[model samples]
Target chain A: MNTFFTIVAGFLLVNIAAGLVRVYLGPTPADRMLSAQLFGTTGVAILLLLSQALSTPALVDAALVLGLLAAVAVVAFVMRVPQSEREADEE
Target chain B: MSFAGLVLDGLLALSLPVLAWRALSARDLYRAVILFITFGVILALAWARLGAPDIALAEAAIGAGITGALLLNTVGGLSRKNDKDDERPDEPTDRVGRPWRTRLAVTVPVTILAGGLAWAVLSFPAPVVDMPSLVGEAVAEGEVSHPVTAVLLDYRSYDTFLEIGVLLLAALCVWSLGLSAVRSTAPEAVSGSPVLAGFVRLLAPAMVVSGVYLLWAGTSQPGGAFQAGAVLGALGVVMVLTGLLVPSLGRGGVVRAGLALGFAVFLLVGVVSMLATGGFLAYPEGFEYGLILAIEFFLTFSIALTLTALFTTVPPREKGGGA
Candidate 1:
């Protein structure tokens, strides 16, 4: 079980890197937001896997906080985009 | 691993990466955000499979629930002309010049860090053999029932207190973003397609039932306020996205109560415990279940409201006036 989790953690780290690539190469602010959102979700997965692998309870609290903070940031950023731009897409 | 756990873990392992890939692909930003939210729920399941119920609860609440809502709300706000149309067309766009070096530099450090972390975890000596035994000693020696809850609410109560504070701060920060102008406005009253509306109605009720079950079963089982609050928060998100609930810039009495209730309940519990038992948050021996239930209930309500407010994007109404 421990080996399984270790391997799973490794896979998650790779996914996080893929997210970083998007942040690096994204063409627009929205694209960057999408990439950062990907990191937030994937980071939670990695933290949970690590907590399991190490049999440590503290990691759960850390992971929980990380998820909460990331989501909050994204929501604040998303709400900042202009209504005029939104209207153009709908029209 | 047990058969069910192995399957759950394997599914989480695959889905998370696949979702991450899609989310960053740049072609379907909305779809990617939705997929990322799904990934959070699956990760919660993975945590449950790993035998840490507390973490599982927290993951389901904060991970799948609140995060997904936040992402969806943001996606709704940015429905524009591809967000890419505004970019400078001729800006040295080094598409091919440094791709290989960029790949190497990114991949190498991630590889080493992940590898080293895993190796350390795998090779680290087991700190103790019996978790139950250690917990048992603490409970018996320290005179507390439900060591895990005690760890969260008392032994590590400082962490729990600060966590609630963080939730409050996040909500405050979201409010400070001046989001009233960007609150969703529809051509008509409706916001989603009929099919999507139908699906949400079906799913939202089930989410509520499951969230309540998780909250009630938390004592002597594998769920709690964090998970339940998160699930409820998800329901709020669904309502927002489907236009069932509108974000209004009004600090109604209900909203204030919801935001402050958790910390207040926790504080009252601590003070009462200190008065009755001469120590903070100390439940009398036979009152364990009752006390945990009360605190968890208030915590769930507070967490759910706080998460909704955090994602609501409505500003704090100015003093002596309405928005």
Candidate 2:
């Protein structure tokens, strides 16, 4: 079961690697930024699996903190990017 | 290790460099910043794989989360300067357009310097003192059950003291450089956003609770003051961003007191310890737990204040409104 969890975590890492494609081929900054959000979810999944695999429950707290702060970049992006700049990306 | 675990380790080791290279070489600033955040997440996982949960916790909060926000904020500022371009390039053309000879001149030395540092780290000699065994034995006698926390607060407390002092110093410097036009002093666009207000309202209590939990867990687990402080510090950042707290808060006497509380207390403790125990930073016999906890409690708050204060700028002090 530990091995199974470990392998599953590896696959999720691959998913994160794949998501980086959107970051590279971004049509907009928001599209690029969402890849990080993808990690926030997928990375938490990976951490949970690795905690079970490695028998270290502390990583779950790391996961909790990661999940909690995950939206910070998006919030910052929304706040910092001016309305004109944000709208300009659409048209 | 099993084949599955081995493969997982290999994949993580391989991808870290790939992510770093991609982040560094990317032409688009926004993409690079996003990739940087991605890299931080993987790096935290790598730390976890290496069995360093404390580092993993700090990296998850500071490396991935806080850094991403800061870099994104900076990129926003950078892009706001760059008008009429869909993709803003990060590097000045002068570096890219420099003659290959000049580029080589810079690159060769940097590569050598990096190699030398790597070699020095790799070639580190075993300590004559047998630090781990010594720490393990000493920690058994100490009140702090966790070796890492014991070492941080008891064994090498001088180092921790200086580090906290540095955080306090950074806040001082930033406050001194107040009224910098680079700061956003006007009304916040973020404060008016209902989504953010709702999110922060939900999250702030969790952060506060977790921060205290981390500090409490330091006695027996990988969590400690730094991790707790990072969470609290990030909370302050969110408050400032949402305009729940004004930037001018950093300049206030109360904030300055909060910022210096840990440093001053740590120093006083050391001085009193020196006189009381005949050794600086030496906890009194059988009172180790209480002393460490007291220091950690104050250190946590000051660290949080310092982190938040560094990111803030304030209007210049008027006459009689001095630090």
Candidate 3:
């Protein structure tokens, strides 16, 4: 069962890696920021799966911390790099 | 390890370098910062696979969350400065003007140095010493059930004490730089959206509870003061970004005291222990857990404040115009 969970987690991680291509090829900062957000959600899933696979309940706490704080970077991005500024940079 | 575990580890290890290379080579500063956050997450997973949950927690919280927020803020600040200076916002201003020959000259020795270090690490022999056994024997007298916490707060607390001092020193250095004028330009305050406002309101309490729980759990599990501090610091970053807590408020007496509280309490505890027990940082017998928890509580507050202040570089104005 643990092995099965680890395998599923590995597949999710591969999906995350695929998502990075969008960030790399982004035409806008917003696109890249979205990719980072995807990473945050995927990371929480990976941590959760690993916690179960590894039988170390402490990892769940790490997941909780990540989920709670991951959106912060996006908030910073929005506040500091406004939509107009990103659009302006494109020109 | 099972086949699945091995494959998972292999994929994680392989992705780390790829993410790191892309982060470094990305032309867009924002892309680079985002990629760096992804790299940090991968690295945290690697730490977990290596059986260091404490390190994994800290890496995720501080390495990814806090550092990503700081980088995003910095990139924003730089672009804003560029706008004021009438420079191209897309172009990096801090690019070095060294010739390719100079770059090659630096790269050669750096490569050789890195190779030598890698070789040394790969060649290291398994320690013949029974350090774990020694620690195990000694840890019984300590209050904490976790070995890492026992080592950090009881066995080798002087190092921890000095680390808190270092954090305090860093905050002091940033304070000395004086407030930058650019902070006043922070987006129209509170984002003009009710959803974000409600989110911040809801998340703030949850983050506080998580931070406190992580600190308390450190006595027996993989959480600790540093991890808890980073969580709280990230909370502060989120609140500040939402305009809920202005940077200038950090200049107030209460905030300043909070910033100093960790180092002060730790130092006081050490000195008192030295004077009374003839050993620095030696908790009185039967009260080790209580003292360590007390120290950790104050340390968490100070760390959170210091990290928040470090990111918010502007002092609060007397007029209180901004949020």
Q: Scored by CA lDDT, what does every candidate get?
A: 0.61, 0.80, 0.82
Q: By DockQ, who's the top model here?
A: 3
RMSD of 3: 3.7
TM-score of chain B, candidate 1? 0.71
Off by over 4 Å in 1: A1-91, B1-28, B52-62, B88-130, B136-150, B185-207, B247-249, B314-323
Backbone atom clashes (below 3 Å) for every candidate: 0, 0, 1
Better of 1 and 3 by TM-score: 3
Task: Report per-candidate DockQ.
Answer: 0.07, 0.54, 0.63
Tell me each candidate's RMSD, in Å, in order: 9.6, 4.6, 3.7
Q: What is the interface RMSD of each candidate, in Å?
A: 9.3, 3.7, 2.1
True contacts kept of each: 0.02, 0.59, 0.63
lDDT tens digits, residue span A52-84, model 1: 766765456445544544554343333334344
Query: How well is each residue in B91-154 modelled by candidate 1, as lDDT tens digits?
Result: 3333435678888998899999999999999999876678777777877755235567657765
Which lDDT value does model 2 have at B285?
Answer: 93
TM-score of each: 0.61, 0.90, 0.90
Off by over 4 Å in 2: A87-91, B79-89, B92-95, B179-192, B247-250, B314-323
Residue B237, candidate 2: Cα error in Å is 0.9
